[model samples]
Target chain A: METLDGYLDMDLLRFTTAGSVDDGKSTLIGRLMFDTKTIFEDQLESIERTSRQRGDENVNLALLTDGLRSEREQGITIDVAYRYFATPKRKFIIADTPGHIQYTRNMVTGASTANLAIILVDARKGVIEQTCRHSFIASLLRIEHVVLCVNKMDLVDYAQERFEEIVAAFKAFATRLQIKEITFVPISALHGDNVVNRSANMPWYEGPSLLYHLENVYIGPDSNHVDARFPVQWVIRPHSREHHDYRGYAGRVHGGVFRAGDEVVVLPSGFTTRIRSVERFEGPVEEAFSPMSVVIRLEDDIDVSRGDMIAKPNNQPRVEQELDAMFCWFSPERPLEPGRKYLLRHTTRSVRALVREVRYKVDINTLHKEEGDVQLGLNDIGRIHVRTAEPLLYDSYRRNRLTGGFVLVDEGTNRTVGAGMIR
Target chain B: MTQSYQLSHLDQLESEGIFVLRETAAQFERPCILFSGGKDSIVVARLAQKAFWPARPPLTFLHVDTGHNFPETIEFRDRFLGDLGAQLQVALVQDSIDRGRVVEEKGPNASRNGLQTVTLLDALEEGRFDAAVGGARRDEEKARAKERFFSHRDEFGQWDPKNQRPELWNLFNGRKQTGEHFRVFPLSNWTEMDVWQYILREEIPIPALYFAHEREVIEREGVLLAVTEFLTLREEERTERRTVRFRTVGDATCTGAVESAASTLEAVIEEVASARQTERGGRADDRRSEAAMEDRKRQGYF
Candidate 1:
């Protein structure tokens, strides 16, 4: 939502930055915020004071975004750190996920809701195992755009062939998974090459700079706009009001467009109802679409609460008892065992699910799917067969992220143990 | 006229907050919303209400009481929870002091504000809560702006901002090796202007202190302190009646207000839009030092 006066409405863009530990993910974010003048005066002052206190000749950009006292001390990103900044063109949310193998779960969580992923690679090292792992997770989460930032191009003399080799390598691996859009940009984030402005060294390159790509990327159609899915979050009564008969189903639209008077089918129970009103605090609206939170009133009072999805009757998701899906195990203490039951939460519906079978584990480096062996541990990505107590309405992960993904909660521990995407 | 898309500022903020709340519920073992009946916390409670529909919020409300609060805030808190049928758990600072876990400051201007950490940490330990959802916004303080979405705390309830995890993308690192807690902020993206615009659009219920009213006050540190039972005029200080409104609510001793005629939500939004100073400018505690918020957060302060 942009403001009226021309100041950006902090049109937040959530993107992930991934690379080997030394690729300058933190430094790049720091530079973006610093150069854009997003940092507060006090923050800059403190950083300046701290820099002088540390006896550094120049202010360290990495110290700007790194908050953890430990991460600053150890010089590594251990958890996912979220930082925000805004330019007149757009507001951005940077998810600074870790590059280590042990922190793979952190990358999954960061990319899950991102509109884009910035996969940073060292120009000297080309494409490494961490680069492939980050790219694979981005694709797994259905991130639409990938900007391959060839960092430290200064070290490689800004050679056009080096950028091509890295881009070719990434495309080959990304081909094994579902990746729609990919852009290759050669830059030195440490030396400020093609980050905010076009680089002078890369004479052969002709594309926009990193910031330009981030500002102009087509993210309008990022959310699914084809399938109508609205999971009722609450029943708003607001008693003792002028309109006492108001029974509005409150929820944020997951997919497609919802118009007033449109007929919708409530899931789990095939009850149908006509849309009575689509109300925000601003009163009734003519239509509502994905990512819009509105209270939808229906003609008939259908038994809908949290976990019940409303969708178009004709384009309904498959109601299946058995689900074939890929899941990323998030916990190290527990292993994915067959015949174990978990509280599987899909969209708004929650049901008991058992691990029916283990399919195979995926190898990120070689882009190979290992079949036959079924032991899934922490950060392990594998396919499995799940039988739910109730049938789930789901689409392929590529079709829609909202209705296509689900989290498995451990019954006793209450931790989100795994995340799944329908095959 | 068919408009394809237009997200009201309030709706967008609510959606984003709800998404973060759900992520916390899905990621952490035990998460609780820190409710103080203030506008920020009320917005958080409302977001939690929206996160899990059909079923009441899966978590509970955790209120750390310093035994010195506006009766209106307490009354509003109870009524709000009652309407939603959500559970409420209170942690008393007085109880902690009485139990010798914390020492009450012995002075006329003494507030149990800083001593709240002991009660807060004790409650977390007793409840076994791994995640505590706070209403802190980045614009509130400079140190807060440097905070991550999921700020991790060690076993001793000390926040090591230096060693924080690298959070990239929408992916949150909710992993805790053991005995560690996370302070999850769903409203980290919101600014004071956004909050005001949202309050105006959503028509969220707020305490009376936010709106201007006639009240007796004493001037201190270039601030107009409302004279309540908890606050008294010092020998050197003089009292006066002024029309004032508060930007934030804390211990009656440290919180202050600005003189304004913005009594309605729209007016407040306009006031926030035109104001050049930050919201926390009126807050006395934060003005103590540059690292005030960071120091408090390390001591388990919300």
Candidate 2:
């Protein structure tokens, strides 16, 4: 590969930004694009033209990401919009989602794939209810890295005392959360302060700029490197004359690593096999690790197919028919109730799931457990017990997100009504 | 340093795209690729080829021809499919017009771009296709930025922007009701620069019209339009000879050309890196209004 191709191979960091609509979240994103040179001149001109049409004196940077017709008309982001940018060090994919508390499902949708999250706080307001709600959701979703961006520092005159006060309050509240890493940065998105480049006004604070930190964040060692989890997505059998009797199990490695000649076992069947080779269209790879999609040829033709799993013989995930999980309801049409059956899809496996119990709902704002709640409504979080028709091969969401996460589809409407993280 | 098993951005994207293609095949009963002879869809075809190597692409390539495309593009579409020994299903706008299913537009600046939607929907329903893979990129348009990898549509094949399903991780929910379907875009994250670079790397052959060529063109509304059989010049429209290349291939009547002397893949990449306008900047269809793309998408226009 050439140097440019090597550049193409740079690490990717996906993060989500959550703030109250019009709290400069879009402005910060626009500034990142502008400073990174990701925005084309014509795109800027279009935004400028729309700003003029909207009768704004200053060109509104928020107009750049408010792409939909209704979103521009309402001047608010209603759904999640994905934006891509890159620096020389790493590539970034921002799932810029709406920040309203009512749109909590959108935030979860964005943060589900993120390695980091940015929860913006208005410096003058100082850790409001929406901020707490976002933090709690981030925690519930198992987002490890959280950066509390104290925005609108210009409104507060970039005072060190004010910044410290907000940071202290956020820290006091975040103590109950499950975040593994946290950081703080005071920025003014409208003026591009401490966003891509550090602001001269904040001479007292010595943290790296947002862009620098995003580029340098340590994202490796994030996946479960010790446990190997491979959920078979597809099986390829070329019963051709030349290469007849060739069978391959194809799937993306969710955790750990697998090399050729490694001993492995097929889940559900508990049959043992040795890996023959890991193949891509390019050719056979020396080794395959987490998140790499490859076709593995096993030495033994064990009856391994889609919805089955492959792992080491000694290290195995729990095989259970009944599971308890934290579920976030997404549909506003109906509330979840017991005795209703759903199509539970986990990793590559799909089976009939019967709702056995609705234990309790959690008020994320107060972190209170509301017992005796029989239903999980839209944007509501609750704990429940589900009985599956078949045994699931899984891990805890805290251990491996890919193997532990699943989504619920309403059998009648076929709508994906909720997503669950196995406890 | 330890052997960090992290993939580069391009490799990750390739893996994601291939995974999406295979998922479509494994999930849907009758799925097809919406081939338009454009560079993006050509990349889609290439990715599909690499995805199911040793076995032909599981999905058929369906071309929604507007009958106003560049001759070179049509030829390339046919020749490429022939080379792959794959299937091609062409849905013609003329057939729709002839059958009175859709009426042809009249007067200047009238294009079949919007009319192709009806023909496309009719063909899809006739074929009972449950999923259609396209090459729409998020960076290409504002409306597309909000598109899901597996965009679900109603039974009418209409896209409801407000009620889109939330997609997370690589676990794309391809579940749909019996009549409805999905429009899967494997190139949702790719930009014009990424496509060109991948083309240069994979040695993917595209239509010759993508490179610079001498053609008689006319300027209108600040965009150069290639003179073709379907294009009838106005009284004030005067043709000029110029070394122009197309940034996007579409209806020759609406799709515009840019002045360029470079004809190779490397030159195209260099030009794209320094591009001042988006690839759709030359496209007049989107210039109709601020919400033109959004409105068209709602009506099932790709």
Candidate 1 residue-wise lDDT, A1-423, digit = tens: 235334324355779887556787877887887777666555676679888988878787777776555555676766666666666666676777877888787788778878899988888998888888888888888897899888889998899998999888878777776778999999888778889999889979999999999988877655677888887755666463465666777777888889899998988698998888787655677888878777788889768876678888887877788988878888767898888998887765678999988889987666688888668898899898899998887887778887778778777654577788888
Task: Encode model 2's per-residue lDDT on A179-267: one tens digit a residue.
Answer: 98899999999999999888999999899999888999888655788898888888876566766777777788889888899999999
- Per-residue lDDT of A396 in model 1: 78
C-alpha local distance difference test of each model: 0.78, 0.87
The alpha-carbon deviation from the true structure for residue B49 of candidate 1, after best TM-score superposition, in angstroms, is 9.7
Kindly list the per-residue Cα lDDT of model 1 for residues B124-143, writing each as its tens digit. Answer: 99999999999998656645
Per-prediction DockQ: 0.18, 0.62
Q: Could you give candidate 2's per-residue lDDT for residues B1-302 as a string of tens digits?
A: 12777777777778788888878888899999999989999999988887776567878889999999888998999898888767999999999999999988887788999999999999899899999999999888889998999998898899998657777656778888888989999998877877887888789899999899999999998999998887878899999999999999998889989999879987877787778888898998989987889999998887
